[model samples]
Target: MSDTLKHLLHPKFLHMTLFGFSAGIPYFLIFSSLSLWLDQVGVEKSAITYFSWAALGYSFKYLWSPLVDRLPIPYLTRKMGQRRAWLLCIQLLIMVAISLMAMTDPASSVSALTQMALAVTLLGFSAATQDILIDAWRIEASTDKDIAMLSSVYTVGYRLGMLTSGAGALYIAAYLGTSMDQYNYFAWKISYLSMAATMLIGIGTTLWIKEPKKAAALVHQTSDYLAVVGVFIICVTVLILSYQLTADFFQSFRNQLFAWSQNRPLSATLTTASQLLLALCLATITARLVATTRWVNTDMIKDVYWSPVKDLFLRHRQHIWLLVGIICLYRISDIVMGVTANLFYQFKGFDLDEIASIVKTFGLFMTIGGGILGGFLVVRYGIMRIMIIAAVLSAATNLLFMMMVNMEKSLVFLTFMISADNLSQGMALTAFVGFLSLLVNRQFTAVQYAMFSSVMTLFPKILGGYSGGMVEQMGYANFYLMTAVIGIPVVLMLLYARKNQVFEFDQQSDQKTSPH
Candidate 1:
């Protein structure tokens, strides 16, 4: 092997790979796995919609990102360095939270399970924090040319994690030899415990890894303690003000808000007073923190206190526009089709058992294959070409479902449709992630990626919410055909974006302007 390839295969690279695995595994445990468990337990479809909202945690992770970016664990911060210390802490929490979730039963007491959902939410938050650090470490550890290979390694580990959570868990349930309902819940608990165990591997890898050197300038910038405090205070105040304004709208229109909030208590007087108190306290503390901590000798503190929000907007205008467009169009067809697929199966007379076994189990492997394949393709060909091809394939595969919808109810046709869809989805997801990774400035990886992912999710998820009503309005054949048609606009946009060479031009301009 070339020395560069040999270096990448060394123990340190393996460590990062395993750590990536640990971070990726629990995500589906709280998401897709939980969805299956809920479906099996006979949760109402409408209630299941609320459960899906729990996924909003992944999308909104940017809210606490500044905290993760800034705060230190009293002694560990100095011992392990900022990034590794934070990563280790969050991994431990994820381990503990998953074990806690294993002990709760969703059917017996949903309120208790809701508490478990909160614990899972905590896991998602911590996992996201770990991802922020890992992405930074990956960038710093590799040379520019090695980035594609490193990304592929990370993708392989991530897909392996997903396989364990999705298909592995299902197989365990199937083999347990219990009633279908009991086996489903038992399988979930076991899967969570297994996920917890996976963290140990990451922890061991982290211990052996060396910390990257801190930049001298970054250290100098954070020495101002008062500035750090001032920035923290202002950020907190803005968050509080935003929340209070939202609360006021809810209170003023209690009936509408209550419906959405599921009738959590709301009164105008209390809402007004609460908002005022929160705003004042937040503003006061923020002012004090920024003033006191502006001179701390840390990059962490500077990032927290600085005006990144404004800077990103002004500096990378074209890139930002590309980010917005990619986010909006990436999964438009897949999500829209997904929202109605279960109903389609039901209409075609497939039992729940058959649907779960075929789509959730076998189809998952197809997705894994596609992810691994796309990763290799990205390494072999560049990200730009892989992205264009993936988009085209994703759009084309929607037609497979349209074809299946016209065929008579046959398991063979169903399998074909599921396999094709999953393959396209996996390939598209791999490319999308790579593209997003390239766009992020490692300094702001978590927040920028979060913004991209959140916008990507919001529109499709909203459209998905109306899917059932649409299926009711239009029959199955028409619905699938409509989904196929939806992919055309995004595919065209991708082709145009590629032909114009937007990202390439931006990179050239950036390199020209940068100081040598």
Candidate 2:
């Protein structure tokens, strides 16, 4: 067998895909599939969009990633090592959270919706934590020679997991008789319960794998672990109090914007911006709380919280803001468009079964193809070149959706749209993820990568929360046009960075050190 085939078949690499799959499941469940559930239950468009905030835990997960990098579970850590122990523990939490979500009926009452949203928040938080540990483990397990391949495998697994939660869940729901005209809560409940069962794949993999060298070597005392846990608890308490205190102010502010603002776009923009700012403020308060505590004096705390930021700024001070801009905006167009995509399809008169088969199942293969092609192009032409193409493709494809608005709902036309859209999505995400991974400092892999990932998704998700409102006010054609137009900024930023050679040095360094 060829060397590439050998590596693909390796057990270590196969397990990495499973880890990626596990991480991918909850993300779509919370973001994509859950939106369909809310819509079918007769939830208002704006309310469904607001429900998107339940996944904000993903945007702020960097806050607690440091703890995952070093914190140890009591008995589990001793038995299976830190990373695996955390993996198993978080997997169980996800299972419980998902099961709870399945049991709640969002259509029951406003209070029930609120409770269901909280359950989603818990699930999102657990899934985000799982991502942190799994990333660290993936990095720790690979040598420099194969990290890229391992990352690709992980991406494949992650996409496959998306397939399950995205298409598989829809198939189940449709089979059990949930449609736009009729709301079958039992259908959705059974679908989610089945999705929850798939968490077993991750739990089994966690138990089957051995701890990597770096993860195994990360040993801390009982007192230090307890102190870190205390610090985490304090931060959580501060975040909760901060949100509760400011919730009314933000709500009133949003109300005023919608009530008085003449320009609808401006109103939507201000509302989303204010909510993003609130999230950032909460994270800042948590950070400040951590710093002011006695734990700040501890070496572990210093290394975890301060050192990563310091190292990143020190290394890239001149280009740090530009890099941040790129990371923050790179995926904005795709995410914002995706937030309302299923709703848009349903509005266009497609049923759940049709959407599941074409958009999810068929689109899955196209995306995987694009991802593989993207990985190859990045290898041949470098990330900057491929990323530019990916960006352009991503922005340009939204125009197809715009055209689809005018055309009749032919399966052929829908298939063509899905092909173009998912291809761009797959390519853009593959390049973007690889770019982020390349920028991470190995010393702070978990924390720094988490920070990068968190920042990248933060603004996009914030904007996505207003997507339904945008659709409500601007209409579908304009929304798709706006999504496309926003990609201009990302392209401009990439061009500026390329002109200034911001990442040239890092790429050179990686190439020089990597084995050929």
Candidate 3:
């Protein structure tokens, strides 16, 4: 047998694929599938868009990842080691959140939708936490040479998980709920309940797997744990107080802004931007304040937070800000339009099952193929080159959606659009993931990876939250055009990075650190 095929069948990669699936499942359940459910129950597009913010936990998961990194769970940590113990507990929380969501009927009332949103948000937090642990494990478990292969395997697993949650969930709902016109809460409930059962695959994997050597003996000082806990409490208190004090002012300001501009999307965007800035500023100040406390240990803070970040800046200090900008905006075009994709398909005359079969099932296979191709190209050529090409393809594919908007509602046309979009998305994501894996210093795997992953999604998700409003104000054609235009900056950034030798710097850093 070929070495590549032999490695592909290795138990290590097999475990990673399952972890990827576990991570992928809850993500689409919260974002893609939940959007469909909300729309099915007659929720307004604007409200459905806002619900996307429930997963903002992903964009800020770094704030809490330190605890996951250093602190040990009471009983669980003793049994399964740090990473696996955390994994099992988190998977349980995910199952509970999914079950709770299944019990709540969004079609019943506004309050019920609110309940469902909260449940989804809870699920999002658990899922994001799982991602942190899994990412850390993937990094720590592999050599530098094999990391890309591992990442590819993980992506394949993640896409498979997305398939289950996306197509599988939809099929179950369609099967149980025969009629499309009427609200059938039971059908949706059963679908979610089935998804919750799939968590067993993850939980079982957690039990069966061994912790990475690096994560197994992660002994930290007592003060480190207490300091993280203390700062967390401080940040939460400050955030809540800041919001309470400014809520009404922002509301009035938002109303006046909306009334004056008569642009719902712009007004909402500005309001959300202001609120996020204020909250982040307040949290930073509070965390800084706690840093100087007598009980707090500066060394602990430096090791946990500062060192990982410092390492990155030290490696690419010249292009750090540019690198950050690239990370933040690289996927903006895809995410902004992606949130409203199912809504668009429904409006264009496709039913649930057709969407499930074409968009979810068939499209996902295209995505996995693209991801595999991307991984191969990155190895054969280079990460930055592949990433640049991926960026162009990802942005350019949005135009396909615009064309679909004007075309007849034929299944063939829809399949073509979905195939192109999903393929581009898969390629872009694989390259991006490979690039990030290279950026991480294995010493601070969890925290560094979390920060990079978080930054990449933060801005895109913020813009995505406004997609529905954008589609409402502007027509589908214009919205897609805007999404496509959003890719211009990313392409430009990649070109600039290529010229500035950013990838060269990364290569030098890796060589210096590599054992060989």
lDDT of 1 by residue, 1-516 (tens): 598667777765676567667766776675556655665676643344334444454555554455555555568778877777777888898788878877777878868767776676667666766776676676666655556556666766665676666556555554553233354566667766776787787677677787766311123233343445456546655754665567646466655554655533222223433554566567666655554553544565445434445555666676666657776878878877776565566557765456557876677668767777877676666666677777777777777777776678888978887888888777787777667667656566545655566677766765554455455556556766787777777666666666676676334534544477
Q: Which stretches of candidate 2 lie over 4 Å from their true place?
A: 216-228, 234-291, 295-299, 504-516
Clashes of each: 26, 0, 0
* Off by more than 4 A, model 3: 178-180, 216-219, 237-254, 264-269, 272-285, 290-292, 505-516
Q: Give all candidates' CA lDDT scores.
A: 0.63, 0.83, 0.85
Candidate 3 local lDDT, 1-516, one digit each (tens): 498787667798989989999998997788788888888888878778887887888998988888888788888888878999889999999999999999999988878987897798889888999999999999888876667778888888999999999999999998987334866889889999999999999999999898788983546775668767888878977875786688788888889999999987678668866876798799889888887987887777777778889999998798898989989999898888889998998898887899899999999999888888887776666677778988999999999999888888899888888888888888888889888988888888899999998999988888788888889889899999999999999899998887665777346534554578
Which pairs in model 3 have colliding backbones?
none
C-alpha lDDT (0 to 100) for residue 295 of candidate 3: 82
Ranking by TM-score: 3, 2, 1
Tens digits of per-residue lDDT for model 2 on 174-261? Answer: 9999998999999999999999999999999999998877763454565765676676677666656666677678778777886886
Worst 10 residues of 3 by lDDT: 505-514
